[model samples]
Target: MNAEPEGLTGTIAIQVESDVVTSRQMVRKLTRQLMFSLVDQTKMITAASELSRNTLVYGGGGEMRWEIIERDSKWGLRLAFEDHGPGIPDVQLALTDGWTSGKGMGMGLSGSRRLVNEFELRTAVGEGTCVTITRWKS
Candidate 1:
């Protein structure tokens, strides 16, 4: 895990071996701690699990950062997954549901994007990939 600065409130970080089962468990634990509506929590958990698996399988190994956001009575969760592996060469095609660089079913990225309220991805051929997902309570 990278060194994080002090006093990062409402933040949780977890590192899992480059394995899908462990990654999914990590995401499930985090999602359970988030104070979101039932539906939103389920959606975000599924998305986070998928992204976590992708990071482990495709990006060698990575870490996930989770933060809680609260505004008035509304609450949300923000998750960021960063990986240092063979970066995506063509992001556009990768975003397409049926397209994949590996032997994956090719639904991870696009499916996760659809489940989140806000999604952002950054990647380069040699550089790593960073995926940020936010889900808000409604």
Candidate 2:
């Protein structure tokens, strides 16, 4: 598992509908524990909900793994979602606002990127896709 050696929080499978709900709950709880404000908590939960859904609906299901990390004397939560479905054909266009591969608002990637301090997406045709995002607490 991709990890933050010091502060592993937990990991959840993004294989079904329930997983998305569970992921949001997990992110909310973790964000709160890290002393994140309600607004930040909402943003984190929303991002997790969207990404977990994308993992299920678009990526044919995968996993969401999270960990706590410390950088520059500040703590943060890191989440990673992975899937083995058909990879995104055009990541650049995908990041564009309103671009939808499915029925989504196409906000999953771009919106989530905005909600976090760090965002990274990796994909390849016929290979798979993985997204990692981190939200920091000041």
Candidate 3:
């Protein structure tokens, strides 16, 4: 898969796991290449970790696509996570913190949304879910 505004791009496939600790580690490794400030990279890594866990737990399995983009002299990173499991029936409800379908903390979606500069999510009952997040250089 291709992420727009391309600079550096990569993809990772993850399986259903309890903690998704490996996925979070991978995000941190990839984010390091972005050359972001320490604080910014930390936030991006945190968001990516949270979303990866969500996909693994809720969607059964999924993949994350990462890319660095440059637009109008601005640089940023973009992530697209896709999964093919029982989809979310109500996006709004799912986005609400503390609202979970499983034994999750329910902050995955909302917290991730807040951590990035741009966020978009698409989900359906059986169609699956796709979440895109972007963090730009300040």
Candidate 4:
């Protein structure tokens, strides 16, 4: 993550499955604007897609916030997915591989973590959940 101040780039409302696709497209566009390689762009887009889906499906709808960050001379894209739905009862279990409470493959959180440069998860049992991820251009 960068020590420099981050500038909010955009936000996408995630209320439906189509919003997940929109999030991915927006992230891909941002990554390309930052001159990220194709692989990096794909990684961010994939992570955004998964997180956005989680927000809509599990969180019952929320939003995705994005920022353009600078660290040293390099650029990065940061995304945060938030929802006010029922939060995970066990954060640790939710993060484990192949552990899902829904029909998903249980790769949304853990897999997104592996695809980005930074990963963060915040949740309250009855409140909601927020997952943040960052991918630095290489």
Would you list the C-alpha lDDT of every candidate in the order shown?
0.74, 0.87, 0.81, 0.88
Compose the digit string of candidate 4's lDDT tens values, residues 1-138.
323232347788999889888888888778877878888888888888889999999999999999898889988888999999999999999999999999999999999999999999999988999999999888
Q: Model 4 segments beyond 4 Å from truth?
A: 1-8
lDDT of 2 by residue, 34-96 (tens): 888888888889889989999999899999999888888988899999999998999999899
In terms of TM-score, which candidate is stronger, 1 or 4? 4
Candidate 1 yields a Cα-based lDDT of 0.74
| Structure candidate 3, residue pairs in collision | 5-69
Give candidate 2's TM-score: 0.92
| Ordered list by TM-score, greatest first | 4, 2, 3, 1
Higher-scoring candidate on lDDT, 3 or 4: 4
lDDT of 1 by residue, 1-138 (tens): 122331223333334543456545545555555545577767887888788878877887677776767668666677888888888888888899888778988988999999998999999877789999988767
- Weakest ten-residue segment in model 3 by summed lDDT: 1-10
lDDT (Cα, 0-100) at 70 in candidate 4: 86
TM-score, cand. 4 vs. native: 0.92
Predicted model with the maximum lDDT: 4
lDDT of 3 by residue, 1-138 (tens): 133233487777868564467656765665665567788888888998888887888888888888778888877888888899889998999999889888888899999998999999988878789999998877
TM-score of 1: 0.79
